[model samples]
Structure formats: C-alpha cells, structure tokens
Target: MPNSEFSGCRWAVVLLVMAAASPSWAAPIEQSDTPLPADCDGLKKLSLPLEDAPPASMASSLKGCSSEDLYFGIGVPKDPVRARQCAYVERQDPDNGWPNLFAGTGMLMTIYANGIGAPRNFDIAMKFACELGGAPAEEEGWLAHLQKLKNENWQGQDFSPCDDITSGAAMGFCEAHGAKLASAARKAKLADITAHWPSAERKAFAALEKAKNTYAAAVADNEVDMSGTARGALSIAAREAEDEQFLATLEKVISGNLPSVSPPDLAETDNKLNALYSKIQKKKDTSDWGTVTKAGIKKTERTWLIYRDAFVSFAKRNFPSVAPESLKRVLTEDRIKSLENFGN
Candidate 1:
C-alpha cells in the first residue's frame, strides 16, 4: 500500500479500537423505573454496593445527586460479592471514573502531538493517542488539552499537530495549533513592518505633503505671507511630486487596498526624495525668512499634535457608556495610561 494509504488505515484502526473500549459502548449506564432516594446523603448511601441489586435499584439510589456527583463515583463498590455486586455497579455506573479518565486522556494526547512526552518516537505518539480512549472527548476539552501541548512544545520551534490530523476527536488539537500559527504569523507581520523602509519614507512624504497642502491653501485663499515660511515650504513641496506618487502606492498597501510596489521602484523613489529634501534644506534660509516662516512651521507642528490628541480623546470619550462601571473605569484609566506613554 502507498504510505498515505497505510497511515489512513492506521488511523482507522486506532479509531475503531477507541470506540470499542469506550464506556458508553462497553458498559452502558442504566435508567430505572423505581423511585429515588430521599436526599443527597441517602442517595450516596443507597448508591453503595447492594447484593443482586437490579439496574433499576442502582438508578433509584442515585436520584438526588447531581449528574456531576453521580458521574464522580458517588455510589461505588469498595468490596466484591459472590453474587457479582461489583460487576453490576460497574455496568450501571461506567461514568464513575469518566472525569479523571477524560482529563488523563486529554493530557496524554497533547503530550503525544507536541512530541514533548517522547520527542523522537512515533510509537509513543501512537501509544498516547490510543490511551486517550479514541474519540468521544468533548471539543472544548480537546482544545484546552492541545493548548497545553502548544505551551509545552513551543521551544523556538513551530510545530502544528492540527495540520497533520483531522478528526472530530482532534478538533481541540486543531484549534490550539491554528491559534499558535496565527500568533506566529502576526509576529512575522510585525517584524516585516519594522524592517520596512516605505513606512518611514511615507511619514517623511506625508510631512512634506501637509506642508505643501497648507501652503497651497494659504496661497489660494490669499492669506498673508505673514509667515514668509510659505515660499520656502512651497519650494520643498514642488520637489515632492515623485515622492507623492510613491507615498500613494505605500498608502494603498498599508490600508490593505492594493499590492505593494516593487522593491526597485521603492528604492529609486526613496533616493529621489532624499536628494530633493537635501537640496531644499540647503537652500532654505530659516534665519532670513522672518517670524512668519517660524510661526507657520510652529502652527503646522501644533496642528499635527492636536489631530493626534483629538483622536485619543475621541476614543476615550466615545467608549461604551452602557458597560459596567468597573469596565468603564478600566477603559478610561487604560486610555489615560496610553496617552501618557505616547507623550513620554
């Protein structure tokens, strides 16, 4: 048989074995027609081993206990009887040890998938998976188990057990593995952002664009060259047409609206903008432009800061007012902390 086919067969056999061993199949719980015990203590005592007790009697004995308690071994046999009282108890109360078995199985499966239990052994993996009782485990329980596996196996390595297996039994495993992969992908993305030259170039270009837009608007409106700064800023703005195009392309990428520009085109744009800025700065006479130029620059800087502050203020002010007071307080405090951090 092909390797893939053999693996598939192996999984099928494993599943079959698990199904056969499950308590629901091997030792089904019984429902009784008899009346229940009076209270919790009576229920507990009544559930204890009873010689030749019918399935109905066993069920009646557990009447007042919660399902959780019933499943937790409330009326278990501590000794054997010639009439097979223990056997009856086991048959009628298969779930007596289910919670512990479920937990152990979950833990074992996680260790196997993560390779933490026996890192180099496929045999151990198979063994652990088999012991997990084959597939009736709850999805959430399995998920939690896989998360624990991920935490154990995350040692500068990215291993995903979910990708290799797909069974209802492994749903939790897949979810946890997917979550880890997503986290890794996010970190990779953030790294890409840090190394990217375009964002920095875009910021510089945006500063120039804002200066140009303000100067152009002032000129159009016939506002005083009250800040002689306008002419020099206009000169810098004129040199930024190529940068403006590059910034437009980057903005599209940052906003997830389009593909990124080619690296060569980006490099060429960066060089061109740097050269233009250098030339403009060399020609700019900050000393001779008079207070108007200084005033205009200061005003532009103030406008940007105001815009930033307003956004933070808006976020805090419009936060869900209907939320619990404690939640609102936390949100308000966190916002204030963030603003302080930004200022620092």
Candidate 2:
C-alpha cells in the first residue's frame, strides 16, 4: 500500500447523532457577533467537573461507557442527557490531549445543535464549533452556516452536524464516530454470547477472535481500494462488515450449522481456487482493478491463507470429529468468490 493510504488508515484507526428534547417549541435566538467569552460561560453553566476531574481519565471512561452509543441508540436506548453530560465533562477539562478535546467538543456541538439532551442552543453549538479550529476558511464556513440557521429560526431537529460536511477529513471524522458505535455494540454482543463458555473453549475463542481481527485488519488495508477521498470511511465500513461476518460465522459454528464437506469436495474447491487465482493474475494487465493492484491482491490472498490455517488448527482442537478438509473447503470457497471479483 502507498504511504498516503497507510496514513489515512492510521488516522481512521486512531480517531474514533441527535434527537429532540421537549414538545414545546422556542423561537430561534438571534445570531450575534458577540465575542465568545474567554472562559466559555456556557461550559461553566453546566457546573462541570461534574465529578472530581481525574487527570487524563475522561476519554477512557467515556469510551468504556460508550457515550456515543448511548446517545445514538447503537446498542442501547438513546440517552442524550447521559451523552451530553459525559462530553460536557470532558470539554471542560483543559488537561486533555488535542484529539480528545476535539472529540468532546464535536460531541457537544452535535448535542446542543440538535437539542438532544438540553434545549437546542445554536449559540452553544457555534461556541464549540469555533473551538474546532479547522482551516480559517472552514471555521468561517461553520460559523456562517450556524449563524444562518439561527437567524432563520431553523429547528434543531431538522439539522445535523454531518449534513454540512464538505471535506474528506470532516467526512472521515463523522464516519469514524459511527464505526466506534458499531464496534462498541459488537464487543458487547460477543461478550454476552461467550459469557458462559468453558475455560478451554473461552481460551480458544479468544485466539479465534485475535486471528479474525488480524485478518480483518489485513483486508481493510490491502483489499479495499484506497484511491478515493472516501477511502478512510470505506475502509472502516469494510472492516466493520468483516467483524460482523466473523461473529455471525462463529455463532453458526457453535450451532453446528455450517455445511459439512467431503474430502473430494475440498479437493475440487482447492483446484477451482488455484485456477481462478491464475485467471485473475492474467487479467491484471488489462483489467481495471481500481486501487487494488495485482501485488496487493496476492498479499491479501496470502493473509487469508494464513488465517484459514489458523482457524482450521483451532477447529481441530475444539472439534475433533470435524474433518480438517471441510474447514479448508469452506474458507477456500469464500476466497474464491472474492478473487472472482477481480476477474470480473
């Protein structure tokens, strides 16, 4: 992969919505040119440091509880109040690193702008937006946009922070928020499903989880075309889909629902896969494969081969009655489908 794509993935891996509150409506506040207070009185009004401000603790704590998940109803009920409180606490803390600060500020902007927990307050939203400090022109764009909405008496429920995203970086930030929510939900589900397994099974499950995650990462990095502006978001979506599929497959495995295969079937699938790969290799010179080069395809295939072997080894220990060739057949068939796309 190119260095730019790698950097984009790093930006995505490291980075990590709204509703109405009351039935009664209030007229939008008039836009003001008033200079924002140095201390940001809006934040102070919340009486933040809602608890003792532990140095460098808010980010990890918020992630653990998944403030976004709660607010957006990803895996749990929507609780904008809880989400607002969590983000507000972090927003007040000056000791946080830049990334966390940016994240907290963005969350608060969404909450206030949408009237999710508190009353819709575009002034407060603009306050948070000003702190975002993107490029000067971008910052001006945000302020102007928010100011127009406020002046026009726009309803908070009608707008979202993401609706105005124009740049790739900003779109990436928005998409990453969603990916985090999905990941949090996925983690909660896997934990619930495996909570009562025997110790040895649990150990094997952990190994399986690690292997799948590694393979998922490889697919995101190597399989997806990263030449577009949406590459970061695209990669994130692909990785999340891979994880969901892995979880679904695991559930099916535990239920013994995967089709059993004979040794001859395995041999046939292996031969088909080898022939398809060679055909794909031949098409590399003439076909439009987008961002995925022939070399990248080979690397991804190698990674999948390793993952298949690891999975088969795990299945041998845990399911001794299951034939090894059956496992190989299933994985090889899936790989064949993916490789066939290259030829198409």
* CA shift of 280, model 1, Å: 55
**Backbone clash pairs in model 2 (N, Cα, C under 3 Å; residues 3+ apart or in different chains), count:** 0
TM-score of decoy 1:
0.22
Best by TM-score: 2
Off by over 4 Å in 1: 1-119, 136-169, 195-252, 255-344
Model 1 residue 151 lDDT score: 41
Error of 1 at 123 (Å): 3.2
Lowest lDDT sum, 10 consecutive residues, model 2, at 16-25
Off by over 4 Å in 2: 1-102, 126-160, 283-287, 319-327
lDDT of 1 by residue, 1-344 (tens): 11211111111101122322222222322222243322222222222112233356555553432321122222332122211322333323434232222123333333334333223222222333443443433433334443444444433222233333444334333332233333344435544643654665545434544544553343222212224323332332322322333244333334535423454554554455445434433445554433334344334334433433332333234332322233223222332332221122
Count clashes in each candidate, considering only residues at least 3 apart in sequence or on different chains.
Answer: 3, 0
Query: Any idea what lDDT model 2 has?
Result: 0.63
Give per-residue CA lDDT, model 2, range 73-110, as digits (tens): 76688887777766655555544333231245666666
